[model samples]
Target: MQQIIKFFLRNKTFLLYVFLLFIAVVFTIQSHSYHKSKFINSANYVTGGIYNSVNNLSLYFNLESQNLLLQEENARLHSLLSTPNYSTSLSFISDSIYSGISYKFTPAQVIKNSYSVKNNILLINRGKRDSIKQDFGVITPKGLLGIVDQRSNKFATVLSILNTNIKISAQLKNTNHFGSLMWDTKSPQVVQLNEISKIAPLKKGDTIVTSGRSVIFPKGIPVGTIQDFRLDSAENFYTIDVKLFNDMTNIEYVYIIENVDKTEINSLLKPSNE
Candidate 1:
């Protein structure tokens, strides 16, 4: 207590000056309209800066949640847009709500991807637990990715379009001519379209998309663009080189499509005579 008193006494003059200065500044600000307004503005600027900084810090930590929400929303929209309508029969006096949606899209993140191997495969975070199954088509927003070939309870493996054994039904955008899309194992960005007739009116920059004849992907889903084409040994079909829109080496998120009527279609197509 004695030391504190001595310390205050020694700084009495300085303390008195600080007190008077604070009072004079307060009186000046209150007496002048411009000064008072400026002081309030200055205080607001400091407080506003602090609040903004804190808000930004909170947002920075919530990016992952925001991204997941966006992915889910995209999956819902994709399902609505990509599902095919298979209603061929209509009654004159209709009282039924015809839901055109016959397909379901499940969003998934790629945990593993391979492009250099001959039989490249992709591993995704979703599996049979998420209703994913074999033969489901995998795609990104920009283009086709792969097909689901194997799955467990919590994970699934996709046969990438870069795989040589995998073949997809693809057709030229300008014509009805369709062919099998396959990888050549030579380049990651290029694939081959076989069985397209030589005289299909193909152009250098023609777009190729899914044929929709299969139960996997919907028709008109973009696959690639024609880079070069030449007649095969028999000259009946063209071996087309397609430049892919999606980079095989760099894939992240994908949507898996499930055709709800796939089993029914397969049953109808099955040949009982054989």
Candidate 2:
């Protein structure tokens, strides 16, 4: 205590000057309108900067969670694609189901992913309450994910594009030749475009995308472009390999597509078979 007192006494002159300076600055701000206004402006600027920094930090921290959510959505798509009947059309003839079409997107997040297996699945965190249901189409902003296979109130499963059984209706963007898209299980980034007519004038760089013939997706939903392909045995068709637009490894937010007229089309097709 005596040492502290001695130190304070020794620095009393400088301390007094500092104290007076502080008081003078406060008084000047309070007494002068211009000074007061400047002080308030300066204060606002400092506070605003702090607020902005805090907000940005919060946003950055939330990104990890957001990414996890996206993975879940992708997982749902993978699961749905695993189902055999996802695109096993009842139409044994020309795909007339494309006649009546309506589609809507319900957003979802993927939580899990698997592409190594012949059959792949993606789990998403959406359910019936969000208008998600079985057979709904899933896609990201970039391209197709898969299809929704089933759903509960809070979660759903998807048949991811990586799944072997997943079939998407696709066509050459420049021509009317359409076919079913499936995975070869050899490369995660590539899929097979089946039933493409040998006479479709296809080349290595030909772009292929969703035909959107049905209400499942909008027309021109990008699937991929032709990489390399060969004629199947019997040589009636070319199974062109497509490079998918959406990178299967990094999928996030997805829009679940519901065909509003699916029931109507299914109902109409019943009697044609008989």
Candidate 3:
């Protein structure tokens, strides 16, 4: 306290000049309309700039939350579309037996992704607690991503479509000619569709999609467009190079699809032991 008093005594003349200058400036602005207007405009400009900067900073921090909300909304919309009676006029539908809904979508975030290796895998922020299980199909708004291969209580691993070990049922759009979607470990942006019949009207830019022959992916989920194709050794099937819709290297958000009838379908397909 004594030191503060001594310091104020030492700087009293300078402090007094500063205080008088501030008072004079305030009085001059108040007395002159032009000066007052100029001062107000300058104050507004400074405050407006500060407010805008703060607002932009807040928005930057809120981006992750906004992305999460968008993912959830997307999942809801997908779930709605999977219902048997989805209509433009309807706002909601009950998931009852009469609703005939087979698929349920759960939104998830990718924590880790790999695409350069021969057997790339992805890790998602959903697991057993979120109803994620092995063989569950994962996708984004653009296209199919992969299938869930393993899960814990809070996380799951996906066998990415870029993996050579994974095979998915894909077909040419609007045709019965289907093949196994596989990766050639060559390009991350392209996948291979094997066993497609050569006589199935081969053409460049033809879209390929899920066939719905398996319990994993629903029918008509886009895989890619036909980039190029070539006949195999025996000339019986065509090995198609499909340009993928999703960029596997940049996956962030995903939807885990649960086919509710999968267990029942698998049970029926199992061989019976008499």
lDDT (C-alpha, whole model) for all candidates: 0.78, 0.73, 0.79
Clashes of each: 0, 28, 0
Identify the superior model by lDDT, candidate 1 or candidate 2. Answer: 1
Which candidate number has the best TM-score? Answer: 3
Please give, for residues 1-274, the per-residue lDDT of candidate 3 as tens digits: 9999999999999999999999888865553321122232211234434433554455565467557756865897789899988675454566455456779999887766678887776767777777777889999867899988766566677788987767999999978899999988999999999999978997899999999999999998989999999999999999999999886866666799999999899999999896
On a 0 to 100 scale, what is the lDDT of residue 40 in model 1? 26
Per-prediction TM-score, please? 0.66, 0.62, 0.67
Q: Which 10 consecutive positions of candidate 3 have the poorest summed lDDT? A: 34-43
Can you write out model 1's per-residue Cα lDDT over 201-262, one digit (the tens) per residue? 98898999999989999898899999999999999999999999886766666799999889
Residue-level error in angstroms, candidate 1, position 217: 1.4
TM-score of 2: 0.62
| lDDT score, candidate 3, position 229 | 97
Query: What is the model-wide C-alpha lDDT for candidate 3?
Result: 0.79
| Greater-lDDT candidate between 1 and 3 | 3
Error of 3 at 23 (Å): 82
